[model samples]
Target: MTNLTIIQQSPDPEQVAERSRTRRSIADKIRGMGQNRIGALLLLLATVVAILWANFATASYEAFWETHLTIGVGDLQLDFTLHAIVNDALMAIFFFTVGLEVRREFAIGELTSWSRALVPVIAAVAGLALPALLFVLVAMGSGYKNAWGIVISTDTAFLVGALALIGPRVPGRLRVFLLALAVVDDIGALSIIAIVYTANFTPLPLAVAAVGLVGVYFTRYLPSGRGPVYATLSIIVWLAFLASGVHPTLAGVAIALLVPVYRPDRRDVEHALELARTFRQSPNSEYARAAANSLRESISINERLQSAYAPYVAYVILPLFALANAGVVLSPEVLQGAVVSSLTWGIVAGLVAGKLIGVFGSAALMKITGMGEFGPGLTLDRIAGGAALCGIGFTISLFIVDLAIDDPLAQNEARVGVLAASVIAFILATIIFRISDAMHTDVDPGQTLLRPVDPKRDHIFGSPDAPFTIVEYGDFQCGFCLKASGSIHEVYEELGDRLRYVWRHAPLTQYHPNALAGAEASEAASLQGRFFEFERGLFTDQEHQRPSDIVRLARDLGLDVDRFERDLTAPEVTGRVQDDMLDAEAMGITSVPTLFVNGRRHTGPYDAQSLIRALSEGPPEATPEPQHPGG
Candidate 1:
């Protein structure tokens, strides 16, 4: 082929895509994108209303927002005030979009290719980790202990909206690059909300969420269904999420992952449009008859369905989120709080500092060391500005702050920081880009965001040197014993130095053929000062953790094999195992996994909080409330 015939690139590859943007006139395209800004405007209006209501408006907006509204029967009633309803319920849809965006970016967007993706993905890691560290450093042990999570999340909507105003200065590539970066940032927010912070579980709401999940799978993923009735099922899922003690906004992300995003086939749409016009013609005429014949032959259900579904996703879902959550009351107190608060400092520093140190720093270092490179049209200055813009931490920030700090001052400070950083990042990025007379940067991202290596699931107990006993009874083949890993982990997270878990074999002879040998292996591990490591594997390995696997695990944990072997077959080992089981039996601990919280009994289904409460409350302790199963 002639060099002249070569086509280096086309933004939209003429292939059918979901809500596909046109590459017609760049200026016109930007303008069209602006129309999409209705979502931003709606968000802004909501923020304004919320702020005015919170600070100055006559009625207590704060009280109205925070007040619980109950639904259903006594004790069965779902209690959530206005803020919770909006934050958890309506926000689920927002999370669904987040899920969709994350999915799509990985599927085809800038995140689809790794070489191009290295910079942003690595940068996102830096962006997420550093800000989180900064917040933790400042908030921990303070009233904001619950709020360490507040600083880590980056709000993409607010970030992008800021970018929009910086028009002509930011290039298309920068926009795509910043978008990919921020989307990953959103995922980080999700991780923090799910893992680092959560309250004790309550059953009803979680049960609702589970049922809603069932409904979603039946209609959306199951083959035996009609098209997803996203409305009713969506509401059900939202309700469940609200009740589950989980921030409900995540429900949106869950739905987005499960919801289908494909546009109806264009060819099918064309054929159906023709059939609709013909259907308008009279029924009697021969031409009408022919039209009817053609129409019957031409139309497809999927095509007609697509036509109906297009408008809802394009207009409704997103705009609603913006309207509900985007209200930022601009007043002197809010502004002053931003200046005086550590949340404000942490946020501004984390973003301004983190993006610079994390994204740009890593990118530059990687490039210099021959490890990574930059997206097209991006200059160092632009990158710096882009980093600043990423400081936009609204939606996720609000969600985290809700969980992180229960105190009013800290929460308010966090809110102020989120608003101010978003605004400042937007303004700074706009100014820098305008100075260079550039608009948007372009990038061909090539990889996906990297999820962290899952930590050792086995419970890590008392440090390498400590003296406390935790007797864990087990049958090698028992399912509960197999499931003990997570249970042990919760305890460890709650009580680190005060205890260590010791394995004992109560192996119901009917269930475990080698239970005796398993206990011996654990005893052997103790001989080599690596019993804890061996116990962790003994519990966590999903498959057969045979006596031999215990040896292998010990070796991996740096045990002295010679001593380990000698201890495994020690004469008194089997009896030691039996004695612990006898103690458990006498205590009426019918369960495979149970804990003695400083000589107090805690049986199966006991989490950290329960165990802690059980320990403290035992021996003339206060009456304990009923335990929530998962909580």
Candidate 2:
């Protein structure tokens, strides 16, 4: 079963219950600890309080986040308000996650292979350019004309969830279409954040941020092969940019480049597996044991070296971020202002109109231009209908609005615009999805969160209740896999119980000469729950196969290499590795480090930073925001 247990240390429940009602009060508040409505409501309350303070309270909103405080860093005096601190400092972590997500998608997920990614890339580029053009056209000479780039974003989580709420009536194409369009929209929004939203740059901070960006250029080739270190460094760079007055979120894009992007070696994999097999199938003699022990040690080392730094950003950070920023206060004034604001109109119009123009126009233009055509069973009406639904830019838009305009009027209007347009687009998309279903006569799937479905039922992977699955496939000799030991530790810290990664053998025959034997060694570790340790050994070493490497790594990680070796080359265990290789080959895998979350393929040469992002995005769209309290 998937690990869905809510944390037992549910917080001081009785205290909150006294402050509110019972069902809606206590349980709600407890639920709020991890981002249910209570948490969002609390955040909303805080934001409202800030607004009240700014507009009416004895203290001002400026006072809440902007209270000037002086601190020392060597001889430099660092002065910033509480607001700037969060926006400039804390927000960098948020951007780091973004960088992780983008990196993974480009390397493996939706964008890695062009055959699968072209549609979205093309759509994203088009979606971005058109919205800016349309916004400029719509506002021509209006008062809030500077916010054109903000109009193109699509909040993936909100839109996709809404799409699921109404179910199959929305066609598969609609969801994929939205994903492509939204991802494209995200790239566009980031560009805008980088170029237009930030403050007048200070040279020192700008230089720092630049230096950080430069680090990313070489991150894919870092010698440490550690994902978390990369993530941490990425954050520092982001802070530098933020301190320099650049919008903090651009840091997410900046950090993504720093992650290592190498695939597993094939020859190393084959060499390791061959020795492992000979040891496993040999008679129960002294020579057999020695052979097994010798081969096992080598395999163990390779696994350990490759596993660190893989999980932190995927669970704790991303989920927490969603909760912190999704809250919005709803009031008559907020509504009235949004109704009158040009920023609101531009976004609403741009998403509603620009999306249609961009998506439909591009699809039609592509078809007519003879560059593209709908896959077998799609129609223009369905395509345009899906296009119209692409106006759901809630999450990314909200993030940008905070960065672009600090004014209360502009912020709320943008929120209202996102909320309104997203709702309308969702409804329109849902209706169109259902219409498409009728035409296709597909089966109807019921909606049930946290409920298990048959694995074959097309519902296992996205369920909140799905088991924490960990997947690993490695070569016995691959060094990068050997280095992943640190990455996995970070993932465990952030996710605790909600994470499950599975291991699969993907010993490539081309390199890592001992790769297959290494796969067998790790499987044997599973017999004693020491697979984690065995994996640690593989990824840490970059050097070629050494007989004592695995044993040494196992000892360091606290495993009995004697028993570990016995199992590592055990006949059935070795057979299991062989079986996995066959299975991976059947699935069209062309590389050594192939990974799958649930069953979907991992697309990139993942470091911890990128893998974590892919895992947390779940079924949520390319972009996600936390659910706020009221609306």
The top-ranked prediction according to lDDT is 1
lDDT per residue (tens digit) for residues 211-280 in model 1: 7777765674443234446667777777676666666677777766654443223244346556657657
Candidate 2 — which residues are off by over 4 angstroms?
Answer: 1-86, 89-91, 104-118, 140-142, 167-181, 212-232, 268-329, 368-370, 376-386, 442-631
TM-score of each: 0.55, 0.52
Any idea how many clashes model 2 has? 99
Q: How far off is residue 439 in model 1, in Å?
A: 12
Task: Give all candidates' CA lDDT scores.
Answer: 0.56, 0.54
Question: After TM-score superposition, what is the CA distance of residue 548 in candidate 2 from its true location, in Å?
Answer: 22
Worst 10 residues of 1 by lDDT: 444-453
The stretch of ten residues in a row with the least summed lDDT in candidate 2 is 20-29
Which runs in model 1 stand beyond 4 Å of their true positions? 1-23, 26-32, 66-70, 73-76, 138-141, 168-170, 202-215, 218-230, 261-340, 366-375, 438-631
